[model samples]
Target: MGVSKLDILYRRLLLTKLFIRGWGRPEDLKRLFEFRKMIGNRERCQNLVSSDYPVHIDKIEEQSDCKILDGHFVSPMAHYVPDIMPIESVIARFQFIVPKEWNSK
Candidate 1:
């Protein structure tokens, strides 16, 4: 099945939270930008991050086969990069938020 709207919102929320927590890199910001473009509604995306939109974390966990730990979603499929690498490089290697289906598209 295709990625659902909830999936997209979950990703947006995760990215926004990451940025707020100072874990975001330039590449992560770019990914958020791409997600905004895909949604075609910048205001809605902003509202989503700003409001409690009920993005079901359990559903996301089951769908993506990922686990949310310490407010960070960890994906087994994501590449492992050393902390010695620059934040940009580490962000580039990790695809933690976006679904694989969207990545293929």
Candidate 2:
């Protein structure tokens, strides 16, 4: 399914809140989880939180000037915002499943 404009707006709003509040509130953390789930990145979000929650929060704080545009992350330092890849394309690029038969070879 294609990302809706509402989703993009939601993400932008959520990130804005995070940038302002610094993720200290439980409500904000819950919202962050919801945002990650919406973007199909819950696992990565969890990993970042578990590995170094403070650092993760710091990174968001550092990107205070960044913006989310139609699901693409845009940084002030970047001259161009790259196109957002479809979910299928992203999954195909990162997912590697070895055939079961390969184990017996």
Candidate 3:
């Protein structure tokens, strides 16, 4: 193979960093940690609630004269600079994507 998996992972991480910055700053790191506890294993990745945002974004794109920028952070701190969104919204929608073993006996 010409490409290394490590290289690919790095490239993907680079893209992720760009996207995260594109959203601006993390509103509440404390809230984020609470989310981490719910999700388990702390991973500081970009949070985008597909269920809400994708649909909301599509409708906005179709409707308004204003240019829709993906989605906005609903958190009070993030209201001004809502780029990264927040994990709170996703957990609110999908519940937790807990492992099968964790759920079943």
- Model 2 misplacement above 4 A: 18-105
lDDT (tens digit, per residue) of candidate 1 on 1-105:
366899778768767856558765756555545654645666554553334422223333334644432223332112322233455443222223544454453
> Each prediction's TM-score against the native?
0.22, 0.22, 0.19
Lowest lDDT block of 10, candidate 2: 53-62
Q: Report the Cα lDDT for residue 14, model 3.
A: 48
The positional error of residue 91 in candidate 1, measured at the CA in angstroms, is: 18
lDDT tens digits, residue span 17-87, model 2:
56558634545545545554644765554443333312111121122444322222222112111223333
Better of 1 and 3 by lDDT: 1
The residue-by-residue lDDT of candidate 3 on 1-105, one tens digit each, is 255798668546545656457733334434554454544533422342334543222222332333333433344324323433656653222212223244456
Q: After superposition, how far is residue 48 of candidate 3 from its true place, in Å?
A: 20
Better of 2 and 3 by TM-score: 2
Please give the lDDT score for candidate 2.
Answer: 0.41
The models' CA-based lDDT, in order, is 0.47, 0.41, 0.41
